[model samples]
Target chain A: MGDYFVLAISSIFINNILLAQYLGNCPFLGTSKKMETAVGMGMAVIFVLVMAGIITWITNTFFLVKFDLEYLRTVVFILVIASLVQFVEMFLKKSIPALYAGLGIFLPLITTNCAVMGVCLILVNEEYNFMQALVASFCYAVGFALALILFAGVRERILLARVPTPLQDTSIALVTAGILSLTFFAFKGMV
Target chain B: MAKSLTQEFVKGLWDEVPPFRLVLGLCPTLAVTKAVENGIGMGVATTFVLVFSNILISSMRNVIPSKVRIASFIVIIATFVTIAELLMQAYTYPLFKKLGIFIPLIVVNCIILGRAEAFASKRGVFRSFLDGLGIGIGFTLSLVALAAVRELLGTGSLTFWVKPIQILGPSFKPFSFMVEAPGAFVALGLMLCIMNLAGRK
Candidate 1:
């Protein structure tokens, strides 16, 4: 229980997927212009990340490791993520049209989001058991969501305060994200 | 024909240069560029995957159905990425470990996939190869520049393969922050701002 708690806290705060680990940054910068879009993308990422994590773990253990086809992990994992994103897109479009509309193009974009692939690779590298892999995956996604939402709030505020010409748009957002990442360092010793 | 091929190659240098002008593949650009070696390693690995995948995809563009083209492109990209990963592990163990997950994460690097869909699928095989090489080299140069600034400021030194060259004397105190995660963003952000300013004039 303590170990799981530590894992959760560390992954969410110290090893933040967006701020520290540098995964899932394309969406972090792109979708963060609006708070609503950020939240929607975050939720979609969490859902897919957790599901892909578990599925990849099962495949890694049963198929890749069994056959000593570790080299195939990258190819296989990406195929899984691509197909999984497609499935989620179709399912959401049918079952929850409103949410699908909210997510819009970002849902399809999640197929290439590095955070999802990064989590799968990290869990495999750490050699986590099934339970630990699930927990770590969940924590990483939570961290991604936490950072994305927080950055979205910052960006929304920055929309009004930008005084410079060259430093507007992505330039300002990158600098703001840098400062946010700096703040995340304060949690380094927590775990 | 030769002129157009050169055009495809030269365009990626500045006009469509990624992670800066194009803003694609920022993840690896920010993550592995702390050291110049890692930057080059990641860049070359990406170039290998990009060039080959682009060529292969261009050649196969006719056979793949349009509806599932994205999926097919991904599978092809992932295969090349796996090859790059395995080759790196076999030849460059230290750099491979330093790059770590970012290497495999190249499968998701927007530049590779973006090129395949936007350029490779529509162009001929030779043109796609040039596009990939140009973009890959541009990415490498950008990474090296970023890594150089970060290393010099963060550690007061720079290194390629051998011993670190001391850029600052013992009296100089490294900023340290320039080498960390925040520094990567701040540095790249400032660089982009400068690039923006320069581009206007």
Candidate 2:
């Protein structure tokens, strides 16, 4: 239990998927303009990430290893992720129109997002067993969502906050991300 | 024809600018920028794959129908990535060891796919080749910059030509953090911010 908590917290802050690890910076800086959109995109990412993790784990263990086809891992994993995103897109569009609207285009974009692929690769690197891989994937997704939402919340405030014209957009956001990343480093000793 | 090819080449250098402006190919950019040597290795490997894949995809663009272009592109990109992986393993074995999974992770880099779909699919073969070369070099330059900063600060020394040319000062003591993950974030974020500032005024 303690170990699990350590992994979870460390993953959230110290090994943060966005700020620290830089796995998901595209959306971290891209879709973070609005709080609502960021949260929606975060949720969409969490969904894909968790699923990608599980599916990739299965494929790696069962197919890649068994068939001695490790070279095919990238192609197979990406195809799984792309198809899964498509399915999720359709499902979300049908069942939860409002949520889908919030996520919308970002859902499709998740197919190419490095964060999802990074998690899968990390899991493979860590050599996590099936259960641990799933847990790690979930933890990674939650961490990703947490970082995105936090950055979005801060960016939302920054947008309204009076700041210099030159540092308004990307500059300010980057500095904020840098500070956030440094803040996350405090969690290192905890783990 | 020559002019159009030149446009594709120049566009990737400035307009597309994979890492800074477009934000594609984040994994390798953030992963291997710890050492200048690692950065160059990753950059060259990626360039070879990108250039070749772009050339092949553009040449065969018409052969592949629109509906399956994405899949075809992936296959083509994956093939070159495999070739890159094998070559790296064969010659630059140590750098390959350092890069580890990232060498394979290059397959999922969105920059490759984005180019295949956005530029390669529409452009002619010669133009696509040039696009790949320009974008690849641009990417390599960006990684070099990122790695230079990270290596200088993180380790306080920079080493080029990994083997057959060992060079580290007696006072060298690595900061260690610069080579770690967080340093990647700091280096890339600062680089991007600086680039944005420069482009502004």
Q: Of the candidates shown, which would achieve the greatest lDDT relative to the real structure?
A: 1
lDDT of 1 by residue, A73-170 (tens): 99899998888888888998999998888775787889899999999989999999998999999999999999999999999899889448988899
Tell me the native contact fraction for each prediction: 0.83, 0.33
Candidate that scores best on DockQ: 1
Best by TM-score: 1
Q: Looking at model 1 chain B, which ten-residue stretch has the lowest summed lDDT?
A: B1-10
Tens digits of per-residue lDDT for model 1, B126-183: 9899999999999999999999999999999887864688889999999989999999
Clash count list over all predictions: 0, 0
Q: Which portions of model 1 show Cα errors greater than 4 Å?
A: B1-3
- Candidate 2's C-alpha runs over 4 A off are A95-99, A161-168, B1-4, B14-16, B163-183, B196-201
